[model samples]
Target: MNSRTPRPPHGSSRAGPPPRPGRRTFGAVCAAVGALVLAAPGCGVLSPGSNGQTSDDITVTSTMIREGEAIPARFTCKGEGVSPPLRWSGLPDETESLAIIVDDPESVGGAAVHWVLYGLDPENPELPEGTVPQNGKQGQNSKEQAAYDPPCPSGDTAHEFRFTVYALKADIALPDGAPLDQALGAVASNTLARGRLIATGGR
Candidate 1:
């Protein structure tokens, strides 16, 4: 029962573009003067689509986690037993539903399922920390239980957990507690876009 606090979406922290040479400098100076007259606050210059609000702007991140790294037992099959927090931004305005799935890529056969959640509100970009929806549809994990079953690799080597987020156009039609394949089928049928984050944990 691994538990983890949800992390907030990280806003980009970057400096503005470098000042141009004389010709561009003169144009910039004029723009700055106009901003002063309008009493507009300074604005950050960013590359297009840097903010995760548009269809092409979303970004996903985990708390102190990276792709392919070993995940801590606290968030694995052997600890405090809470779902890890996940955060994302930049969904297309038309997104209606969201789904999340976490799995172990190094499981016994091909890959193993750990957690599956679907029908989340796209408007709510952050899932509450340590949440494992007891009543939500629990899919059949690798162990065949309708609950989160973290990776417990047999050997001493660490295992990687891949967390994925899907932006869908509609709620999946599957029933609660559906099997993993059924749930995934619904996602593939309706997904408009998706993103991923990875972390590792082992005994």
Candidate 2:
């Protein structure tokens, strides 16, 4: 997808002023920010602080693809490039909201964030194919677009895409179109538990 990538139905156009030229690549942005992104204060590079939460604490599943399997082309840049369906359970009883971030940390250009989404309803455990939950909010991806930029890894080797979910103590109050860094920081801070469902995709 080019710069004109269309927003998913759940995406918002209200993100702050469009990203400045040359600031399109997330890796560049992280480098420019020094240790901010690396420290989990800005970028979603590090998973939210678990505060004792463990990956085995929650169970994330998806009918579109199995754990560690290759993501189907239908949900990648090779095909429709739509968001895949996801389901999760085992949230803490105190969980009040949820967040999901899909990213490729091994991207040649640095860690490329394909999607930044938050404010999901804690009670809702499933997201249908190509869609976000009704209450979910969309945060700008590394390209500064608030949509799913389907993975299109270069070369023959597949790229690992982390579909991580965070169970938060409360719903985030970020505005629609918030930057990825801001949204991720909020999610990380409020996270009560977290889990991941890894999948791969490539040319």
Candidate 3:
């Protein structure tokens, strides 16, 4: 009598052989590597609106507005919409350039970047009202405008605006009308010291 071939053990797949232990481990490693690769883009040295406060602080002030005080109407949308006069001191001796960033923290979508002025001469410790320093470059604000966009908070609640000055160790060479992120990144990376003057604004 002819004998029939015995069936394979249960749980054994006939379609293909079971995966080897080495292959399974390799697959797991590949999956882990893939996960790491996918997560790399979001891993940045600095988050938006953060300037890496790892160094000394400078003293920033304004002639027309005091810290924590309501900003003058001339500097807001309700009036002439001109930039406010600002001053700062305590710059490190190694500072080679200066930058200014004005923003409103209470904005709807993150901090509204009102103005980004970089490549200012370190020799000038103050900026006149409504003036861009000589040879300074302007960056796009939250409205995508290349010039200063005065703070205009919606609703009746007053919004606090930050006028930050960065003292950088190296001069930035960004072109005029650079993107806000690019200008901020350049300022933050080279910042040797910084200061802030907080003021409020409303409709």
- What are the Cα lDDT values of the candidates? 0.54, 0.71, 0.65
lDDT (tens digit, per residue) of candidate 1 on 129-149 = 566433235444444455555
Q: Which candidate is the best by lDDT?
A: 2
lDDT of 2 by residue, 1-203 (tens): 01223333342233234544433556565665443342233554544443444244678899988998887888788898888888899888888778888888766656777887888776667777877655677888887777777888666755788888778887899976788778766776677777788887665
Least accurate stretch of 10 residues (summed lDDT) in model 2? 1-10
Pairs with steric clashes in candidate 2: none
- For candidate 3, what is the TM-score? 0.72
Candidate 2 deviant stretches above 4 angstroms: 1-23, 28-44, 48-56
Per-residue lDDT over 45-125 for candidate 3, one digit per residue giving the tens place of the 0 to 100 score? 122334444354689988899988888888888888888888888887787888888776565544466778888776667
Listed per model in order, the count of residue pairs whose N, CA or C atoms clash below 3 Å is 16, 0, 0
- Candidate 1 global TM-score: 0.64
1 or 2, greater by lDDT = 2
| Cα TM-score per model | 0.64, 0.78, 0.72
The CA-based lDDT of model 2 is what? 0.71
Residue runs of model 3 more than 4 Å from their true location after superposition:
1-53
